[model samples]
Target chain A: MSAPGQAPSAGYAAVFVHEDVPTAEVDRLEALHRPLADSVRDLVDATIRTTVEDEEVRAVRAEVDALVARLRARQLDGPAGVRYNAEGRTWSWGNAVVGERNAVAPPLEVVRDPDGLVHADTVLGAAYEGPPGMVHGGVGALLLDHVMGVAASAHQRVTLTGTLTMRYVRSTPLGPVRVEARIEREEGRKVFVVATLGDPDGVTVEADGVFIVPRWAV
Target chain B: MSAPGQAPSAGYAAVFVHEDVPTAEVDRLEALHRPLADSVRDLVDATIRTTVEDEEVRAVRAEVDALVARLRARQLDGPAGVRYNAEGRTWSWGNAVVGERNAVAPPLEVVRDPDGLVHADTVLGAAYEGPPGMVHGGVGALLLDHVMGVAASAHQRVTLTGTLTMRYVRSTPLGPVRVEARIEREEGRKVFVVATLGDPDGVTVEADGVFIVPRWAV
Candidate 1:
C-alpha cells in the first residue's frame, strides 16, 4: 500500500479532504487533495504562534467551530484511522493531531524522502498558546510525538510512541516553523528517533523519542 | 525525597498527592469548600465520564466559571507547574494528565514499591467515556504516561515520555479501576516501561512507553 501523507489533495489548494462522499476507491482522494491539506497544515502552526487579538480569536473560533459542525454533520461514524489506498497509499484525515480535513488539527503533514528521512512544515496559531505568545510545551510534545511516530513506523513496522523526551531550548514563538525528524537506532521492539521544531530564526524545541511495538503487538 | 500522595483527605486515597492545605492557607474559602482536592479529582473524572444532562452542564459551567474567577482573584501568574517542599514532597496540581489539586485533572496518584514497581487505582465515572459508557483511549494513555514517567524517574532522573504504545484489549468500562507499571529496561537516555489499566471485570488496556532524558537534560 502507498504510505500515508504521500497522496495529494484535490481541488482546494489549502483544504485536504473535500466533502465528497465516501467512495469504494482508496487512493483516489489523495491525488486530488494533498495541496489543500498542505496549506491548512501551515494554518495550524501559524495559528499557534500568532499574536492575534481577541476579536480575531473570536472570529477564528466561530469559523473553526462552524467548519467543525459542518464536517460533523456528514462524517463517517468516527475518526479516520489510517487508511490505505488501492496502490497502498495511506490517508488519515479525521485525526485530531494530523488529519488534513480536520481544521481542529494543526494541518500537519509529514513528508518522507527517498532516504526515509521525514520533514514537515506547518504554521502554529494563537490557539495553541500555553505561555502567552508562546506555544505550549505539551502542544509541542503532541506535535513531535506524531512526527516521531511516523519516523518509527518507517512505513514498515506498526509502532506506537513508547517514550518521548523533549528539551525546550527556548520558548517557541507562535508562527511559521519547520519540523524535522530522523530515526536514531533500533533495539528489539523499540525504535529511537530525534526531531526538532524551529522557526526561520532557528530551532526552538528538540525532541528524542522511543517508539515500540509492544510485546503483545509484536 | 518523600513521595507525594500522603494528604489527609480520605476521599483522596485513590489519588497520589494528598497533602492538605490548611484551609487557612487558601485565600479563597469557597474553592476549598466544595470538597477536598482529592475528591474533586474524582469529581473531574466523573464529569468526563458523566451522563449528566444539559441543564447540569450549564449549571456546572456557571459554578465552575465563578470558581475560576474567584481563584483568579487570588492567583499566581500562571498555571501551576511542578512544586516541591523542603520536606521533599513534590506536587504538580495543574498537569492536564495528572495533577493533584487540579479539579480538571484525572486526579491520579501512583505509588511505588521498594522493588521499583508502580501501581495506581482510580475511579472512572461519567466524565471519561469515549464510546457508549467506555473510558476514552486517550485518557487512559494520559494516566498511564504519568505513572510511567514517575516509574522511570524513580527519584533519580527526570524523564519525559518519548514514545507510548497502547493496545485496547477491550472497552474500558466506567468504574473503579487499577493501573500498574514497571520498568522493562534502560538504555542511554531512554527507559522502557510497561503498564495496564483494567476494571473489576478484566484487563481493558495495556501499554508500553519509552521515557527519555533529553540529550541536553541528561
Candidate 2:
C-alpha cells in the first residue's frame, strides 16, 4: 500500500485493475481466511477477559512474542489494498469494518439489495463495549458509516465519505443489532445516504451521510 | 460486563464508588500493557499484510493456534467492564479506541483538558485504511465520537451520545491526524460538542454531537 500523502504504489494500483479472478479462488481464499480471523477474534476476547496472575501474564507475553516473530519471519510487502475482479467480486481484507481477515472488526456482514438499500446484522460483544451495558457510541457509528457508505456506492463506483451525522435515540445494548441504509438522493458526484443502527427493540442510532466520488476516482 | 439487555453486574456498581488508586500503580500497569499491545498490533498488521504461500500460511496458523490455546488455558469469567479509582484515574482496557490491549483498535490516545476540551493525535496506518490513501470516513467519525464523548463527560459524570453530525470537508489522508472537541453548550442532561479530525495540512472532517447524561447516571 502507499504511504500517507504518497501516490498509489504498483501493488496498490493492481486493486483497481479489472481482472478476472475465478469465483472458486475467491471463495477458497475467504474460507481459509475466515477461520483464521475467527480464531484471532476469540483470542482478542480471551485476552481482555483473562485475569491470570501477573507471573502467568508475563509468561504468556513471552510466548506470544515468539509466535509473533515466527509469523513475521515471512510477510507481505505492505497493506492489502482493495481488489475486485471483473465478475463484480470486491474484497478488502484490510478494511476496518468488514475485512474478512480483520479480527478487530465486529463480526459484521453487510448486504445491499436491488432497491439500493443496505442491510446488515452483527453482534457487539465485550470487545466492542464502551458503557456499562451498552455498545460504544463510536462502535455504533462505525457500523452505520460502513453500511451507509455501501448504500452510496451501490453502483460499485468508488465513493468516499464526505460527511456523516448520527443521532443516538437510545443506548444500544451489546448483542444482536441490525443496520439499514438507503440512498436519499444524488447530486452530480455526491450521494446522500441515510441509515440506522438498532436492536430488536427498535432504532438506537440514526445517521445521514454525504459520499463523494472523488476527482481521482472519477 | 453485562450481556445484551441485562442489567450491569454488581461489580459495575463499584465504578461509582471511586476509591483512591495511586497514580504510580496506574502508570505502571499502563506501561506493562503498552508493550504487549504494541506487539499484538504488529501481529495484526502482519496477519493482514502477509502474502506467504498457502502451505507456509497453514503451518503458521497451526503455531498460532497453539499459542492461543496456551493463553486460553486460564481466563477471566467475563468482560472487563470500566473501572476507576479515587485518584481520578480511569482505565478501560477493552475500549475500542484507546484500549492498549485491543489489537483491533487503532492506536489512538485521547487527552481531555480542564477547559472541557479534548485533544488527541494518532497515526492511521494500514489497519485503519478506508479509502485509497485516505482515512475511512467511519474511522474519522469513530475517533471524533470517542473524543467528543470524553468532552461531554469531562466533568466525570456519565454521558452517552445522543446525536452526531459530521460534515466531510475533504477526504482525510492516512497518517498523522489530530482531533479536538469541546463542549459547546448544555441543557438539562444534554451537552453539545463540536470537534474536528484533521491533518497538518488542514481540517478534513468536522463534527457536531449531542451527548446525554442518562437518567441512571444522573
Candidate 3:
C-alpha cells in the first residue's frame, strides 16, 4: 500500500498526509465510506467527553499514532486543498478534526441528503475535555464552523469563515450528539448560516455564522 | 514584590483586563501597568512574525514556561476571574492568546487611554504562522476579539465576544504590526467595535465586531 502523493510523504510534510482516492471511483464507494465516517465522528465526541484515566489516554494516543503511521504509508500532497474534479465534485480530507481519510479527525463525514438537510452524528471521548466532563468551547466552534461552512459552501464555491457567533446555552456533556446546519441568507461574498448542537438535553449550543467567498475566489 | 494590588493596577486591569478589583489600591498601579501592558502587546505581534529559528523557540519557550510556573506558584488559583470591586475594577487573565499570566499566550497588553482609543503593539513569531510566513487567521481574531471586547466592556461591566467579523485585505506577513480599535456604536449590552492590523504597508486586515454583555451581567 505504498502510494505516493504529489508531495513527498516524509519528514516535515508527513503531518499532512491523507488518502487520496481517485475521483471517478469515490461515487461507487461513498455509500460504504459514509457509514464509517459517522463512526469515526462518534469516536471524536467520545474522546472529548471521556472521563478516562491517564493510562487510557496513553493507550489511545499510542494506538492513534500507530494508525497515523499506517495511513502515512499512502498519502497525498500537503492537505486536501479544496479540490474539484472534472465532474464538479470536491472533497477535503486533511482537515484538522474532521477530514475524511484523516485518522486524527473524529470520524465525521457530513452528508447532505436530497432534502438539503446537513446533519452529522458522532461520539465524544477523552481527548477533547475542557471543563471536566464537557466539550471544549474552541472544539465546539471548530466543529460548528466546519459544518456551518459546509452548509454555506454547498459544494458550489470556495468560502472562508468571515464571522461566527456562538451561544452556549448550557454545558454540553460528552456523548452521542447530533449537529444540524442550514443556510439563512447570502449577500455578496458572504453567506449566513445557522446551526444547532444538541445532546439528549435539548440544544446546548446555537450558532450563526457569516462565511465569505474571498474576493479573489471564483 | 508580591504586594496584593494597588489602586492603579486595579485601574489598569479595569482598562485592559476589563474587570473589577476588590481593592481600591489597584488604581495606584494602573498608570504603571498600562504602559507596561502596551509595550508587552507589541511583544506579541513581534513574536508572531519573528524569523527566529528553532533554538530561539526553545529558549523563548523555556523562559516563558518557567515564568508561567512561577506565576502559578504565586496565584491563588489561575488568573483573576472577571470581577468588580466596589470601586469598579476587573481582571481576567485566563483569556487565550493575551492573558498576562497565561504562559500559552503571546505578549498582549492592551492600553485603553482616557480618550477611549484602543491601541496595541505586538510581534508575531513562527508559532503563530498559518501560511508559512503569515499569522494564523484564528490567532488574529483572538487578539482582535480581546482588545475589542475591552473596548465594549470599557472596564465598566462584563462583556463577552458575541459576534466577530474580519476581512483579510491582504496576506499579513509575519513581523511587527500595530492594532487600533475604538467603539463605533452601542446598543444596550451590544457594543460595536472596529479595528485594523497593519504594518508599514497600510492595513492588511480590518475587523468589526458586536460584543455583548450577557443578560445576567449588569
Candidate 4:
C-alpha cells in the first residue's frame, strides 16, 4: 500500500480548478447566491414546523417544485467543484459546510484570525435537531470538521481530513452556537487540530482531527 | 457527576413524548411528507448547479420565498420533537437523519436485521459533495453515526451518541452508497457500535462509536 501522502491513489487536486472569472464577479455571485440559500434555509425550517392542512402543504409543495423547475431550466451538469481565479479569489458554492449556494449546508461564516485560529458563529434551527431540541451529534461533528479543515487549510494550502475523533460532552441546544478550531501541531504533511462546539452555556463537543496535504497537491 | 445509568442531569425522555396519534394516521402523514422532502432535495441540487441568468435566479428566489410564506401561515412554535403513539408507533418528522419531512436530512431508508444489524441504502447527490465529486468526509461521519445509533438503539432502547471516531479509508464518490452498522458489545448503559460507509466498489469510511442510554431512561 502507498504511504500516507504518497502517490498511486486518488486526490482532490483536480477539484481545485483555476477559472478566469474576476474577483468582483465572484463576489457578486456570492452576494446573489447567499440570499437564495438563506431563503431555502428558511423554507426548510418552515417545512419542519408547518401545521397547515394537508391541502396547504400540498399546494406549497407544488409551488416549490415549480420554482425548482425554473432554476433547472439552465444549470450546470454536475457538482460545483472548487474554483479559483488568477486574482486569488476562490469559491465552492456547492460545499456541504459553508457553500454560499448550498441551503443544506449550515450557514456558517468562518473567520480565520491572524494567528491562524478559525472560528464560526451560526444558529442551528429546527432543521438541524437530532434529539428533542438539541443539535444532532452528527451535525455537530459536521460543523466541527469543516471548521477544523478551515484551520488546517490556512496559508492557501489544501488539505483533506485524515482522521477525526469527536467527544460529546453534553447536548447542544438548537440555537446560536460557536465552533472554534486551531492547529495544535504539525508533522510532515499532517496537521493536528483541536476544536470545540458550544452553546451559550458551555462547551458541548470537543474534537481532535488530523488533516493531510495530499502528495499530488504537494 | 451522575453515573452512567443513574439519575441524570439531562435526558431524552422528555422528547420521546407519548402522543396518542394512531399508527394509520402516522403512516398517512409520512406518505404526505416524504414526497415533499424528495422534491426539496432535488431543488437543493438544482440550486447548487444552476447557471441560469441572474434575473431567472432572482425570480426563482421570489417564488421560493412565496412558498415559504404560505407554509409559515400556520406552524408549531418550536421543533417537531420525537412523538410516539399508543400502538407503539414512533415518529420524528424533524430528525436530521430519518425525518420524513426534513428536506435537509438525507433520504436514508434504514433497516434492522433480526440479528441486530442495522443498514441503510441511499444515494448521495451533488448537494453532499465536499471535494468535487466525492462525499464530504463529515457527511460520511454523519451517516455512520446515525446508522450506528440505530444499531445501538435496537430492541426499542433509546441511545445518544457519546463519542464517535471515524477513519476515512478513501474518498467516497457521490453516488449509490450503503451504510451498515452492528452492535460490537455493551457495557452497562453504553453500547459500542461499528459501522461503514461505502460506495459500490468498496468501503470508503469506517467508524467506531459509543452510544449511551441516558440515565433517566434507565
Candidate 5:
C-alpha cells in the first residue's frame, strides 16, 4: 500500500489504492463532517425560501462571503482526487451522490444486501424539490443512478454508468422515501441493474441501468 | 392566471401555471443570482478539499453555523412552491435542474430548437467530478434527465420522466459539454426522447427517456 497522498506509478487519477486511514478514524471524521453538512443543507433550504428583506439578504450574503474566505484561507490546490490509505479502505468524501462533505446531496446511507441488492432511505427535503411539493425527477434519477451504480460495482470491481432508463411511476413527494437497486445481469464488461424509488405509499420511480467496466478500470 | 404564490388548485402540486414575472425581471434576477451561486459552488469545492487542522475546521464550522443562523433568522415557513404570475412566462428558481437559486445545479441554459429539439451547454467543474477528473456518472444522468424531460414537455404540455435509460459511452471529463434531446416518438401519454452528452471531442453519454403526461396533466 502506498502512503497517504502518494499515488502509485500508474497515475494520480487512475491509482485506486487498496488502503486508507483506520476504519475507526474514518468513521470519526464522517461523524464530524455530517452535522456540518446538515447545517449547510439547512442553509440551502433556508436560502431558497427566505423572504428576508432585500437589504437583509444582501447583509447575510456578505457575512457568508466572509465565512467562505476564512475557510478558503487554507485548502487543497485542486480536486480531492480519490484517496485510499494503507488500511485498504477507500474514501471519496467529495462524491456528489455520497460525499460526506456535500450538503447538496441528500442524507443518503446505502446498504448492500447479502444478496447484492443495494438500498437506501432518505428524506428529500425542500432542497431537493422540483415541481411544487414533489421531489425533482432528476434528483430521483440521481439517487437511483448512484445506488444502481453501486449495485453494478459490487465485489470491488469498478463500473461506470453507461446508460440508465428511469420510469416515474408517480411524482415522489418531498419526504421520506426508499431507493433500491439490484444487478439484473452482466455481459462481459456491461453490468445491468434494476432499481426503484418509493414513498411509503408505493414505488414512484423505476430505473434500469447499464454500467460498464471502463477500460482503465479493467 | 392567478396572483403570485396562488395556485390554480387542481391540487397545488399538479398545476403548472403558464405565467410569471416579465422576461426582463426574470433575466435580471438570474444575472443577480449567478455570482452568488458561483461563489457557493466554490465554497462547496473548497470545503471538500480543505486540509486545515481539525481545530480550524471546527472553528470554520462554527463561523459557518453563525452565518446559517443569521440567514435562517427570517425565512419562509416551507418549501418554495412553484409560482407564476400572468406574464405568460414561468420560472421555478429552485428547480433541481435549472433553478437559478440552486447552487448545486450546473448553470445550464437549455434552448429548444425550432424543430422541437432541446439542447443546453454548461461546464462541469470540480464540484461535479466523480471519477478522478471526470464528471460524475450520476451528474451526467442528471443533465440528460432534465434535457430529455424538457424534450418530452415541449409545446406547452407538461410531462414527467416516466422511464429514462442512459448509456455512458465514455468518461466525460470536467469541462464544457453540450447536451441535446429530442422527441423520438409519442404514444398517448408517453413521450419518448433521445439525448446525448458530449465534450468537444465527441459524445460521451447517450440517453433515451420515457416521459408521461399524468392523468392530472391531461
Candidate 6:
C-alpha cells in the first residue's frame, strides 16, 4: 500500500489484488482478527464515555501507546487493499463498513438471500451517534452504500458507487438498526439499487444509488 | 446514553445539552483529551496494518483490554451528546464527524471563512479505505454531510440533515482531502447547501443537501 498522501500507481487492477490464499486460511485469519476488532470497538466506546480522572486517562493513554508500538513491530506497508483467492473467496479486512478487522466499522453482518436481496442487522453504538441519540445521517448513508454495493456485486461482479441519494423519512435512533438493499434495475454497466436504513419500528432513511462496473472490471 | 437497543426519550432538546461549564474549563478538558484521541487514531491505523505473530497479537489484545478497563472504571451513563458552555462554546466530544475524543472520526478540523463558507482539510487514512487505496464513497458523504451541516447551522442554529445526494465525479485516493460547503439558500425551516469532497488534484464527490431546523428550535 502507498503511504497515506502518496498516490498509488493509479488503476483498478492495482487496487484489487489476487493473493490466491486458500479459503481455509482466509477463514482462519478472519477468526483471528475479528475478536481483536471487537475489543477495539469496545475500547472506542469506553474512550468516549469514560469519566476516569485525568491521571487515569493519562495512564490509559500510555498503555495504549505501548500496545500500538507492539502492533507496529511488524506491519503492512500500507492499507489492506482488497484481496481475492483462486477459489473465489474475497476478503477486505480493512473495509470501512464491513471489514472484520475494522474496529471503526459498525458490526454489520450482511446476508444475501436467494431472491437477490442484501441485508444486514447491526447495533449502532455511541461511536455511530450523530444527532443526540440518533444515528448520524452520513453513517446511515455509509451502511446503505456498502450493502447496496453488495447487492450490485452479487455473483462476484465488482462495482463502484457512482451516485447515491438519501431521503431522511425520520430520525433513526442509535440502537438496533437494519439495512436492506436490492438491485432495482440495470442499464448496461450501471446497476440501480434501492436500500433502506431503519430501526426496529420502520424505515427511517431510504436510498437509491447507481453502482457502476468500472471499465477495467467489465 | 441509552443502551444499545433501548429507545431514548425523544426530542431535539434531549440531544443538545447545556452544561454552563466555564470556557476556561472546557479548554482545559479539550487539552487533556485531544492527545488521547489522537493516540487512539494512530492505534486504529496500526491495528489495520499490523502483521505480527499470533502470540504477539494475543498479547497486545490483553493489554488493550486492560486499558479499556481502566478507562471504563468510571464513565458517562450514555453517549456524549453535544454540549455547550455558558460562554457559547460548543463541544460534541463524541461527534461522528468532528468529535475531538472520537478515534473513529477522521482528523477533520472544519473552519468557517470570514464570509460564512465552511471548509476543512484532513487526512483520510487506512481506516477509511473503500475501494483499493481509495476513500470509501460513504466516507466522502460523511465528511460532506457534516461540513454542509456546519454551513447550514452557521450562527449557532441547530439543524438536522433532511436529504443528501452525492455524485461521485471521480475516485478519491486515500490521503489528504479537502471538503468545502456553503449555504445555497433557505426557505422557512429548510436550508439548502452545496459541498464538495476532493483530493489535491480536484473534486471527487459533489453534494447538495437539505437541512431542516426542527420545529422545536424554530
Q: List the residue pairs that clash in candidate 2.
A: A162-B168, A163-B168, A165-B165, A166-B164, B19-B86
lDDT of 1 by residue, A125-185 (tens): 5434433344545556556766776777785655555445556566566678788888988
What is the overall TM-score of model 4 with all chains considered together? 0.93
Where is model 1 more than 4 Å wrong at Cα? A1-218, B1-65, B215-218
Q: Best candidate per DockQ, number?
A: 4
Each candidate structure's TM-score, on Cα atoms with residue i matched to residue i, is 0.46, 0.86, 0.47, 0.93, 0.87, 0.93
Q: What are the per-residue Cα lDDT tens digits for candidate 2 across A89-188?
A: 7677777788777676765688878877789998888778776546778888878888887788776566767778887787787889999999999998
Ranking under DockQ, best-scoring first?
Answer: 4, 6, 5, 2, 3, 1
- Which candidate's lDDT is highest? 6
- Alpha-carbon deviation at A66 in model 4, angstroms: 1.4
Tens-digit lDDT string for candidate 4 (B10-102): 454555577777989889988887787778878888889998889888888888888888888999899987777777677778888778888
lDDT of each: 0.53, 0.72, 0.51, 0.81, 0.72, 0.82
Give me the overall lDDT of model 3: 0.51
RMSD to native for every prediction? 12.2, 4.9, 12.6, 3.9, 4.3, 4.6
Instruction: Give the per-residue lDDT digits (tens) of candidate 5, residues B93-161.
Output: 677777767667775778988999889999876677676667777788778877777777787666666
Of 1 and 6, the candidate ranking higher by lDDT:
6
Task: Name the candidate, 2 or 4, with the larger DockQ value.
Answer: 4
Per-residue accuracy of model 4 over A8-83 as CA lDDT, tens digit each = 2245445567778899999998888778888888888888898889998887788888888888888888898777
Which 10-residue window in model 2 chain A sums to the lowest lDDT? A1-10
Output the better candidate (4/5) by lDDT.
Answer: 4
TM-score of chain B of each: 0.72, 0.85, 0.62, 0.91, 0.84, 0.92
